[model samples]
Target: METNLTYEAAYKELTEIAQEIENESVSVDVLADKVKRASELIEFCQTKLRATETEVNKIIKQMENQ
Candidate 1:
């Protein structure tokens, strides 16, 4: 897992992996590796979304109170 991957990058990679798998284009030799990478990207994307949602909510609350 890369520490510096942005949400967009991870999401793009995940999408590509899904397409490759769906199209049956990935070779068996590297299928496991691609699946693992996809899992990591999914987790990273989920975490990023949650953090963004929390930050946005906090900012909205601040604005409402001001």
Candidate 2:
């Protein structure tokens, strides 16, 4: 996995992986790898969301204090 993966790219890959899993398109040999990748992507997305939420809250607090 690349360290520079953006949130959007990770999210897109996650969606594709989910579709593949749902449709049973992934072969048994590669199923584990796909699930692992999805887990990584999900973690990345969750971290990004948490960071964004924190920043937004800070900005709102500043605005309210003004």
Candidate 3:
């Protein structure tokens, strides 16, 4: 089973995309596609982050009950 992405990995990818977008050499048409993909990635990262937080909270609650 695959675990969710770690914060570092997600942040690194986001940073890379930003850097690529900043470079003037990218074409206009491709830029829109890139931006759309980046948006989706951002949403996925956010969802994963929230899920991780929820799981952590559940684990902590269970530990406290033990």
Give the candidate number with the greatest lDDT.
2
Ranking by lDDT: 2, 1, 3
Quote the positional error of residue 19 for candidate 2 in Å: 0.6
Task: Please report, as a residue range, the 10-residue window in candidate 2 with the lowest summed lDDT.
Answer: 1-10
Tell me the deviation in Å of residue 20 in model 1.
0.6
The TM-score obtained by model 1 is: 0.95
**lDDT tens digits by residue: candidate 1, 1-66:** 778899988999999999999999999999999999999899899999999999999999999999
Task: Go through the candidates in order and give the clash count of each.
Answer: 0, 0, 0
Choose the strongest candidate by TM-score: 1
lDDT of 3 by residue, 1-66 (tens): 126767677668777888988886668879887787778778878888899999999999999999
On a 0 to 1 TM-score scale, where does candidate 3 land against the true structure?
Answer: 0.76
Residue range with the least summed lDDT across 10 consecutive positions in model 1? 1-10
- Tell me, what's the RMSD of every candidate? 0.7, 0.9, 3.3
lDDT of each: 0.95, 0.97, 0.79
Model 1 lDDT on a 0 to 1 scale? 0.95
Candidate 1: misplaced stretches above 4 Å?
none
TM-score of 2: 0.94
> Once model 3 is optimally superposed onto the true structure by TM-score, how far is the C-alpha of residue 20 displaced, in angstroms?
1.0
